[model samples]
Structures are given as C-alpha cells and as structure tokens.
Target: MTASSSIGTGPGRALIAVYGLFSLAAGARATVQIAGRFQEAPLAYSLSAFAALVYIVLTVALWRGARGLALVALGIELAGVLVIGTASLLDPAAFPDETVWSAYGKGYLFIPLVLPVVGLYWLLRRRR
Candidate 1:
C-alpha cells in the first residue's frame, strides 16, 4: 500500500500507538494477575489476556495496512468490551477481579471502549 493509503500514517499512527500500548498494558496485567492469582479470578484474567491478543493483532493489522483484518479485530474488540462490561456490571460475582475490558475499561479511563470506534472510523474514512 502506498504511504498515503497506509493505516500507519497520519492519524492512524496514533491509533497504532494506542493499540500497541493497550497490547502491552493488557498483556502485562493479565500475566501478573494470572500468574499471581489465577484462582482469584480465572475468567477476568483470561479475558484480559484475550483482549491483549486482540490488541496485538489489531496493531499489526493496522501497521501492515490489512484493513479487513483490522476491521474484524476491531469488531471483536468492541463486542467484547460491550458484552464484558455489561456482564461485569450485571453480575459482578462472575468477575471477582477486573479484566482489561471490565466496566468498559473504566480503570483505563474508557479508552478500551472508545478505541475501536475511533479505529473503525479511521479505517473506513481512509478507504474512500
């Protein structure tokens, strides 16, 4: 892809950076939580690790200008946040500890909730 059409350029650079940051943050958080106290909240820790994996894939997709893959990953990310956020609120007992997507990423200032929307917008906008 040309530089002009590359998702890693211009505004997409910020998106990629945010995704990379989330990958690291979520991965590290999950590793620590899982290794230290998996029994405390297996679901929550596993979900955090899953979110980290999604972020890693999304970041790579954006960097490589793989719009289709990025779109799919973003959709999954958004759905995960929404579903997990609602589940955590409605049934707190299910999540003894918090995941990266807990409460729509409240701990991370809701960036997890909004990032995919912004990414979808950026990718779609770049297409035209």
Candidate 2:
C-alpha cells in the first residue's frame, strides 16, 4: 500500500532482476552484432539494439518505481516482440540474422515474448 513497498518487496525484486539480466544480455549482443556485422542485416541488428534499449528503459523505470514509464516501456517491448516475431517468421529475407524478438524469441527460449507479459502483469497487480 505504501509507495516504496510496491517496488521493493515481493515479486518485484525477481522481476527487476530478470529484466536487468535481459537488458545486459540484449544490449551486449546488439552492440557486438552491430559492431561486428551490421551490414549483414542492418534492420535486424538495429532492431536488436532497439530491443535492448527497451529492456534497459523498462528495467530502470521499474527500479525507480516509475509505474507509468515501466508500463509504457513494457508496452513497447510487447509490441516489438509481436511485430518482429511475426515478420521474422513470415519473411526471413528482411532479418537474415536474428533480433531479440526473432521467432518470438525462439533463440532466447521465448523469454523475450514472455517477459513483457510478466512485466505488464506485475505492474497491473501493483497498481491500485
């Protein structure tokens, strides 16, 4: 019921940690891929970096207890996963390599697709 408790207690911590890991993983992968072979699949690489940014924003917002910002970031993440996943599945030419959302996060054990859902649910449950 209090302010900080909503963000500091319960499942929030687990969610925050997971998001943090995802941020690092995606960000590092994007940076390496973009720097190494950006020309190979510019769109896919760019999308990878964008997904990393979304994960970072969501992680920070949640850590700072910014409910609205977290929600918005998670919304973007979910949309990105859906759209990119669908596109990658339907057409492989545009994304020769793989972004975080490729195949609905098939490469990442589908965590990319599920994370946003969990994040959104956590935000909603914490919201009064």
Candidate 3:
C-alpha cells in the first residue's frame, strides 16, 4: 500500500494539503481580525474566529484519518458558508465588514465555496 493507503482511503495527500491551507489561512485571518479591530466588526470578526476554529478542526480530523469528525466539520462548514454567503449578499448592512464566508468567499477566491464540496466528496468516498 502507498502512504495514502496507510491512512483513510480518499484523496489522501492532496486533501491534507488543501485542509492545511484552509487551516492556516482561516487561523491567520481570524487572529488578525480579532486582535486588531474586533470592535469595529464584532459579529464579522467573531464569525471569522469561528470559521478558523472549524478549519483547524477539519484539518486535524482529516490528517488523523478521523472520517467521522471530518464529515461533521465539513458539513457544518458548508452550511455556514452557504447561509452566511447568502446573508452577506442579501444584506450587506448586516455585516459591517467581511467574515470568512462573506460573499461566498469572494475575497478568498471562492475556495470557501469549493472546499466543502471536495471535503464531502472525500468523506463519502472514504465511507464506502
């Protein structure tokens, strides 16, 4: 078996890399936003922090081959991006600034929109 087969059977190294990118990006963004000017956009910054937490959890779960936790985190992340994406688009005023999911992650090149789909696919494939 390959190194990937030694873990859960899915996308393997590629998925880990993607998850790592998200973990780093989200964590850094949240850390800066929450630390710098949280008072300016409390809700948005808080949501950013939450998104970072989810990303971190998702990354670790995937790395450890915890398919169940990965699925749960990815599902929650998908729902969050969708709901917040729509809300941000429909009600710009509701958000004083941007969150991780704002505008469907337009600021993040829509990766927020795409990552969950990939994650779900990997998770389902591993389930079989």
RMSD of each: 1.4, 1.3, 2.5
In model 3, state the lDDT of residue 90: 94
lDDT of 3: 0.82
Cα error of candidate 1 at position 15, Å? 0.6
Residues 88-113, candidate 3: write the lDDT tens digits. Answer: 98989889898889999989999999
* Candidate-wise lDDT, in order: 0.93, 0.88, 0.82
Query: Considering TM-score, where higher is better, how would the candidates rank from best to worst?
Result: 1, 2, 3
Candidate 1 ranges beyond 4 A from true positions: 1-5
For candidate 1, lDDT tens digit of each residue in 1-128? 57334878989999999999999999999999999999999999999999999999999999888888999999999999999999999999999888999999999999999999999999888888
Candidate with the larger lDDT of 1 and 2: 1
**Best candidate, TM-score-wise?**
1
Clashes of each: 0, 0, 0
TM-score of each: 0.96, 0.94, 0.89
Worst 10 residues of 2 by lDDT: 1-10
Better of 1 and 2 by TM-score: 1
> lDDT for model 1, on a 0 to 1 scale?
0.93
Q: Could you tell me the lDDT of residue 62 within candidate 1?
A: 91
